[model samples]
Target: MKRFVILIFIISLLFTGCWDKREINQLAFVQGLGIERGKDDMIHLIVQILKPGLLAAGGGGAGGTGGGSAVGKPYAVFQASGVDFAKAFANLNDELPRSLFMQYNEIIFLEEKFARSGIYKTLDFMTRNPEFRRTAYILVVTGGSLQELFDLPNTKQLERYPYKEVLGMIENQKNTSSSYVCDLNEFLEMLEIPKEAPITGRLEIVKKDGKAIGVRMAGSAVFNNDKLVGFLEEQDTKAIMTLKNKLRRSTLTLDKGLKGEKVHISFVVIKAHTDIIPKVKGKDIFFDIKINIETHMNEQESKYDLTEPKNLEKLQLLINDKIKQGIEHALFVLQKKYNADVVGFINILHQKNPKLWKEVEKDWDKIYPEVKFNVTVKSIVRRTGLSSKPIQPR
Candidate 1:
């Protein structure tokens, strides 16, 4: 009996209530962050915090209708400055009533000036901090005020939260295939590799009538390690995504020469893949990119019987040529213009020919600009859509 009582007493002692637990109301949850360079050699930090009460109140009562008008903005914005990223983040507490929490942070925006100056400080802070989630997306703000981006009014009525709207813009990349996005984890991983450079999706303020109304996400910011080197235009960005096998779906519109006239045709890409092969001849090196694409005819402007075997072959050839041109242009910009290997050429070389990679690794920067590239594209039009030919005038 005595042993049973002692054991029961010991078990009871283990039932202590929630220690080191913080109440939700006492912590401010950050939705997004913007980093920029400030005056006086300080770093500026902007944060968007979610207001739970306001959001809950904004949600309609029983049916999805009324309370949205009564509630003010569902989030608040705050800014601060410090000598370093860590100190700048810490300084937010001075203006905040609750402890700032970052577990829910979804996106991070780096101002162009800050990124150009070098993002090593910001990258260092993010990598060392356990509070920041690795999956949160990172972007570079180009040619705009970071504060204005944060202050964008949710006028579109498409999304209630400003951060959600911006996040949705990044998500749109999968459909448009004109931009590229990467999370903090991916960016950090690329930074760790000497041969690989890091790139982030580009963000800019959308204005109409000279007033900032929303934000736009397009193109990409190319970086040589932690410093922003240049920006890739939308077309180049799309080509890079295709070459890297990151494109899910996209539409290509090209003017085709048919019957001594030009006809516009649109192809909806269904599936696409690229094979990069590295060739070595003695000491000379070359890369061959073989791109295979599967697409469907979406639109045809003129009454060209494309269903015919000969016409279909010509259409496929045109598509192949168009894709080849895009890939070539992208390569020209990356190699000849920027001299930055944002593509996975290093990875291909390391995997396919590690021995050769070792010999040329040191001179990759100098040789990359002069490296020759051969591109071959093949496209198949699997479906002609509902009608094989354009409808004739009745």
Candidate 2:
């Protein structure tokens, strides 16, 4: 009986042997992944591979933070091409000595041309792959391709970690621009709804003295389904953020006072909320948007006394008009010009009243452009900043 027990233990040990386990050191860890179309009209996949040896040597800058981003040119670049994204993404295996480890990949950039052509194919592999994280930042390169952007040098950067830089861009702007850092999962979820369009962060290389120095997060890239339609400018993007109920903090620069001597007052939005109310008028569709915003006067160029209740009330009215105008402008550009509904109004209808959505889901696109919107803003001045009134000239 004792011999039988010993034999059973030995058999269990034999079955427990690792058949598919991969060692971290033996794998070629990827830092960033870039996809674009090549001259051959095929998909090109670019990967920034991290060297474990150099990483083990110990380094400062972004490397110390312990992410997959490359420090300087210490990382290797691998380019592979094929007919489809799946084939191109897999072709890198033949070029690298170690197994391609995308589990560490931090960012993915797609050229504007390819993104406009339709990123459905590239997204398929990334989403379906169990190794890839859904949290990786995804951006559309508008100004230049990954090669050109990565080749640039940045002095402000602790090291040339493009992934870290892009991540930092969203991190630093957390207080100013609502959380606009979009990931692959969020984008995929948005694409599932035909009534909603997905927009990703826009990336552009900054050039000075005829040289690319660094990269900047350029607003956002709007997509009509899988194709790139247009972009939301700074103010337009802010308006959308407000409507999405994600505007954590932002300042509104309003031109008030006399026409001949107009003054710009920057109102810091302390709190904001938006409610979308859809109305079905016979066969026509209309929307009633209600916005409530609370702000504090941050900076002023006029002699307006923000401490005064009467003056504050007047200022609130001006802010109301401004907010309404901004929202209207964004709606015009998105609905009239692009015909893209990134606002998710249709989904709102479905959620609020599915029966109604079923009736107009087919013709929502046709009704979208023709649909009229009524925007109403109610604003309040919560507090006066350090000063009660504007700084008078000495």
Candidate 3:
């Protein structure tokens, strides 16, 4: 009985301390959206620091309809500039009462000029900061100022900030490869690899009624060692996603025999697997890529007889062709044009045949462009909803 009483007292003592406790009202909560720009060759930081009271009040009412009005009168938006990012952040301390915290920061936007100038310096601070999360997405503004991107108003169904809205869009879309979140850790990993290149998300603002409506992700910014080498269009990004097996649910529109007519097909990927085989034939090296994809048909624009085996074969061929084309295009762009292998093919090669990779590690970049690849894609369409037939009358 005495021992039990002592154990209860010990448990009670554990709950009595406030050693690291912080009051909610005392600390500032940052939503984790920031924009960096360059002016006069110096760095400028613009942070979208959230106002808790305003956010709470906005969500208090029914239908969550108070975001625009509340955000219009923001709790605080600040900009600071300095030679270094840390110095700039310190400068901000003078302007605000609370410390600049980045625990919840989700997105980082860089102006085109700033990105083109170079992002390595700015990225150093992000990676080194203990308060920052490695999962925060990094983006490049295609053709706008950092302020413009940050100032874009929230116009979403759920009354959230424009920054949060952009993050939500990327999270919600599966067809779009550019929407995949890229953080500092992934970016740094890509940089460390000599053969692999890194890609950052792109954002562009859309204005309506002279007010910022929203910002959309354009594509991806391909980088060759902290330098902006080029950009991958949306189509190219899709191809990259297909090769990397990162696609979730996407629609592919193809010309299905009817000369002028187009067929739209949506697929929900059930399972996807990829295998890379590296072959060394004396002086030549070849890569054999085999991908197995299983999907359920979500939509079909035109009528197709799935019951007939012959028609189903044709549909299978069409899917294979489309997937093949996408892979080929992605490889061409990554190897011939960009000269950067963002798909981690070298890692696969090393895994498959470590002995061969060790010998050719030094010349992998030169060899990568010369290496021939044979890609084979197999797609299985399992089901075509309840009513497989076309809804429109024949």
> Considering every candidate listed, which one attains the maximal TM-score?
1
Q: Tens-digit lDDT track for model 2 on 29-108?
A: 78888889888789988887766656766542224444434454656678999998888867887777888887777688
Tens-digit lDDT track for model 1 on 138-247?
99987578888877776654666677777777877788886788999998988887778888799877788877887787699898878899888888888998888988
- Kindly state the number of residue pairs that clash in model 2: 0
Q: What C-alpha lDDT values do all the predictions have?
A: 0.84, 0.80, 0.71
Model 2 worst lDDT window (10 residues): 59-68
Candidate 3 lDDT, tens digit per residue, 1-394?
A: 9999999999999889888666655555566445465567677778777776665666422113344345353445788888877888778766777777677777777777777767887778877878778887888776556676666654442544556567776776555455544777888898887667787777777666665556787778888778777778777886676667676666655556323356576656666677778888988888888988777777777777567777666676777887788788878987899888778777777888889888888898788888888999898878767866668684
Off by over 4 Å in 3: 1-26, 52-71, 154-158, 175-178, 207-212, 258-268, 391-394
Residue 359 CA displacement from its true place in model 3, Å: 3.0
TM-scores, one per candidate? 0.92, 0.91, 0.84
Clashing pairs in 1: none
> Where does candidate 2 stray beyond 4 Å?
1-10, 60-72, 154-156, 258-260
